[model samples]
Target chain A: MADPRAEILRQAAQLFAQKGYVESSLNELAAAMNYSKGAIYNYFSSKQEIYDAIIIFTLTGLYETAAKAVSEADPPVERLRQFMMAHARFLADNYDCFVTMLVGFSGMANSGLKDDALALRDAHEGLLRRILQAGVADGSFREVSAAMTGRAVLSLLSWMVRWFKPGGGKSAEEVAQEYHDLLVRGLLA
Target chain B: MADPRAEILRQAAQLFAQKGYVESSLNELAAAMNYSKGAIYNYFSSKQEIYDAIIIFTLTGLYETAAKAVSEADPPVERLRQFMMAHARFLADNYDCFVTMLVGFSGMANSGLKDDALALRDAHEGLLRRILQAGVADGSFREVSAAMTGRAVLSLLSWMVRWFKPGGGKSAEEVAQEYHDLLVRGLLA
Candidate 1:
């Protein structure tokens, strides 16, 4: 079995994604995981804590994998392509957490949770910015503010979580590959 | 003055956008407009009808505008460009209704509301399909299924409601233009 703490966060993220954070109660989360209230409390102090943990965990893994992909690839365009593939794979693999986080999981909006979430998101953006800056320096990327382009790229990749259905015509790999093409080659034809 | 009926729907959409459908109550909707409960009922039968009407009114206008935009443009790419421009403008112009209809208002899952809402969405997709089909026929858009491409395009454009802030570094026009360039021109250097 998966680690209990990870399992608890997974179930909480799934429930939170289905219902808004406020609407999802500790009771429902426990029920979904077949855990008693005490079992849940043993792992998490409160719901907000669970949300913060998921956000930090998700963002850290995403940025770390992206950085690793960039380091492993030689050319900047290939790195960019790999970055899109990695990001898309992360979302596709963790659809519930990805959708809940990107599409405004209410729990994360709690006043206490916001700062930590944003800080991690800022770190993720820094990773993407570094990749883009490197691409520009190497004559692979077009001239655009790393900040604006970062937001646009992140927004595009994150937006897929909300719409890309699993069993539809294209697999995640195919969609990511197409987007990767769009990113590296652009649409200019 | 705006028709009281239209005014009620408008205010409801705004509130629904701000606070979600379940969270925004009829009493608050009426109170927000300083109208008595009876006054709101005088315009619509119930909160649900108002919800239905709001979507119908918004989607109808949007579909009409999109159809018209695509019809008047010259080339296939230009037509797609026009559709994106109009779609983005509508979303930006009426951010509240856009959000309420798209993400925040969530009554549709198994409710009777789903069919009507789905139909409204399909109508808009039909418009996109025609434009994309024309583009493919004219050798402009890369050969992509109208159905899937339409989904991807809507997913891309719909995210603007969540991220774009007025008076931000990029105006809606600039952002729309950039997206248009991205969608049509491809991202290759």
Candidate 2:
């Protein structure tokens, strides 16, 4: 395995998403992992740690992927689209982690990790707002409250985790394009 | 208590939302209800039963509320907006059950109840798609794929469960209006 630790998190994420943090057990995770029950403990001490890792890894990775896509793209409108598409692509690639990050973690025991995860989520929101602000400043998008627009766009994109499934008809990118069409058309000056 | 059975469901919904389906306990629920553990069992045989009741009660209520608002509204566009606003009101009026309905029931044991819930959810989607279709038919909305537009609108509204809170800056109605503004403007020909 390229990264046994990462593998544990990946396997655990599916377990966590399918069940939940409170319902999941390392014994079950170990069975899923094909590792000794203690082997998981070697990588992470508790399920909470693994969940913390998921929140951190998923949100941090999600933000990085989206930010990179936004930065590589041109003016704000395309960047906004890029941000949504990138988020879709990331969630599609890491379905379990995205599910855990978005819906499965709410009742989780709050800690610095949960705070960190929320901060990363907020940072991603900030990125979208900045893109909207840039779009309006550059006369690409209509004048609107970037904060509210950011929340709306994030809602459309984030809600995908709940509904978008691989081969659930449309690819994540395809769905993202439809959302992008609606959003961009809505925002175009 | 308004209705003892409903009171049980309401208390159970908060417990389910705060913990989760598998993690929640009828004992805890009874404590929340100020009823004995045996009293809870008298109302619902199992946690699964409580969850089933929640799925049935919440989705059926939500769909009916939306359908009534849509039927009572004027044009298709207004109907669509009313559907969303009615949903927000329902969710706000029934916070715990909405939370349980929206995010907490996944991964629960599938049964006729889940199928019923999904059908109700699809019925709601059908209502939205029909509105978009009506809007397009009447030239009140642009020629858009009603299916995709319905999905987008549902995404925008459903995700509110995750973020919208009473007195959390914007009321759910206000947030729905903002989303409605984005959506209606987007679909305007």
Candidate 3:
């Protein structure tokens, strides 16, 4: 069996994603898990702690996945394309986690986790900006502002969480390929 | 003085934007507006009604703005560029309403307004998709999946609400122009 702690986090993420974090209750989460409230407390001190753990875990996973996607020796454009595909794939695979993070980041205030979440986001954007800068420096891409372009592309990719339905339409791979074609060709010098 | 109803909505939008709709309360909204709960009830029946009104108002405002932005008889590519800039400017100008709508749409479920909200979003996306299709048909843009490209462009523009700070760095015009250049150039044949 999976660790009970892991199960708690997983269930909490689902609840948070389905309902906004503020709307989700520890009692409801415990009910969903078929655990007593006391049992839940044995694992997590509070709802905020569960939320923080989920944010930290998901952001770390996302960053590591994106970083590895671009670490290969491919050219800048290819590296960037791979990075985006990896990102879309990760989001599709962990749809609940992505939704939870999106809701949490947008709605959370006066929480210690906000700074960590923002820092993680900045670092993620930083990774994409570096690739854009590399593409420009290598004369493979046009002279666009890396910061703006990076944000635009990341925005295009991240918004998938709002609309992407796993089985309803195009597969994640196809969507990624289409995005790569549309964006990379636009950037080619 | 502004209409008391409009005043209530404006204050509610600010609170909703700052705090998630689920986290915000009618009593807090009334308190913020310096109105008693009874006075607020005269304008809105409940918290959800205020949210629905804001969603309807903002979405209607957004759709009207985008529709007007592209109604001129420019070439399809020019129309598309104009459409994007108009969308970005609207978001920048009505930043709080945009944020409120975003949080409201994402977190709203089992609410009476969900279908209305979804219909409005589809209509908004429909406007952009039509422009993309026109550009493709006229050969002003490369062959591309119009639906996918439209979502991508909309995502890029909509996500701006998350990070755009009015006086922090780039002006709204600059951001709009940058997005136009990056996306339009990508779409050109």
Candidate 4:
């Protein structure tokens, strides 16, 4: 159930993630896809275009999926936990692609990508903020600074991408559960 | 008093932190220091050399300073809190430099810089890990995975570089204090 273009991005994401944009050449990417270098140009005009596309594709996809997960859940804490688990699943399934886009975006020059990147990040954090705000309004959460607390929680979740190995000791589910419990419920006995 | 050469790196660090490495040119950096481009080259071979030097100088200086702060404290929790506060001050005092080095490191392909970068990170985290382990052993802090906790705490701290505005309403001391409260005491009120 995959589009050919999606297939290309999946591969490109892995390559782009492993070797940065400058280091990842078109010929190598084409060979990985079993196509001529010209075929890549047919899909993407230039490497910069490809990089832009991959970043938007990956980040927008993540935001939308997180939004969907948030909508279908009931309790605010459950919603947050589901969001974390969904994120963990996405990273687990698309490990290299995820890492590549993150590092790429981190190191990219201030191009038009800056606006889009900020917007994407804002949109993703917006989901978490809404949940936190709702919890505060309903007296389910504390009277903390919603923006800072939301950002901190998201930061904690995103840290998984930095250290999570594909075949690490714990499954993504287990890790996500532990994080949610620790962060949301606290360590009070 | 700062050395003349150290002053150059410090100025360059501020520029690189603000404008980014690639966007910043040697001529502008030299001009800021009232030195010609040739004079800068006398100290550094290339812009990349300047960047590498600044990163090593800033992070190593920060690591040593934080280590000293922790050493001057008693009990692991107090030491850990002081370490976090010292780091926050370092980042706050040299916000641009911290942001530049962090964002700059993501894209760098140089093996020498990468090793040093990762090592510097490990050293700081290792210091935290030891404190956390000691706390757990002594029963001041509850049992937890020291490795994951260290990474989580670090991720939370490092994120300040991205969003914290230097002259914002809160001081680094205030923010670091709140962050320490959250990490050590948890959020169960």
Question: Taking the tens digit of each residue's C-alpha lDDT, what string does model 3 give over B1-189?
Answer: 469988888889889888767778998998887889999999889888888888888887888888988865787777777788788877887788888876667545757888988798889888888888877777778888778888788888888877886667887767877887887665222
Q: Estimate, for each residue in A1-189, the C-alpha lDDT of model 3 and write its tens digit.
A: 469988888899999888778889999998988889999999889998888878877787888889988875887888888888888888887788888877667544656778887788788888988888888888888888888888887888778888897777787768888888888665222
Candidate 3 chain B least-lDDT 10 residues: B180-189
Candidate 1's residue-wise lDDT over B61-157, tens digit each?
7787777777544876777778888887777777777777766445455446667777777888887788778877777666766775676677677
- Candidate 4, residue B130: the lDDT equals 91
- Higher-lDDT candidate of 1 and 3: 3
Listed in order, the DockQ scores are 0.46, 0.47, 0.47, 0.29
- Tell me the TM-score that candidate 2 gets on chain A alone: 0.92
Which residue runs does candidate 4 get wrong by more than 4 Å? A22-28, A31-34, A71-73, A104-119, A169-173, A185-189, B18-37, B46-48, B71-76, B106-119
> How much is the lDDT of residue B35 in candidate 1?
90
Candidate 3's C-alpha runs over 4 A off are A106-115, A187-189, B106-108, B111-113, B187-189
**Whole-model lDDT per candidate:** 0.74, 0.81, 0.81, 0.75
Better of 2 and 4 by DockQ: 2
Evaluation by TM-score, superior candidate among 1 and 3: 3
Comparing 1 and 4 on DockQ, the stronger one: 1
Cα shift from native, residue A186, model 4 (Å): 3.9
Clash pairs detected, candidate 3 = none
- lDDT per residue, candidate 2, A21-69, as tens digits? 7778899999887889887777888888888898889889889999888
Query: For each candidate, what TM-score against the reference?
Result: 0.89, 0.93, 0.92, 0.82
TM-score head-to-head 1 vs 4, winner: 1
> Which window of ten consecutive residues has the lowest lDDT sum in model 4 chain A?
A180-189
- Superposed Cα deviation of residue A101, candidate 4 (Å): 3.7
Provide the TM-score of chain A alone for each candidate, in the order shown.
0.88, 0.92, 0.91, 0.89
- Work out the iRMS of candidate 2: 4.6
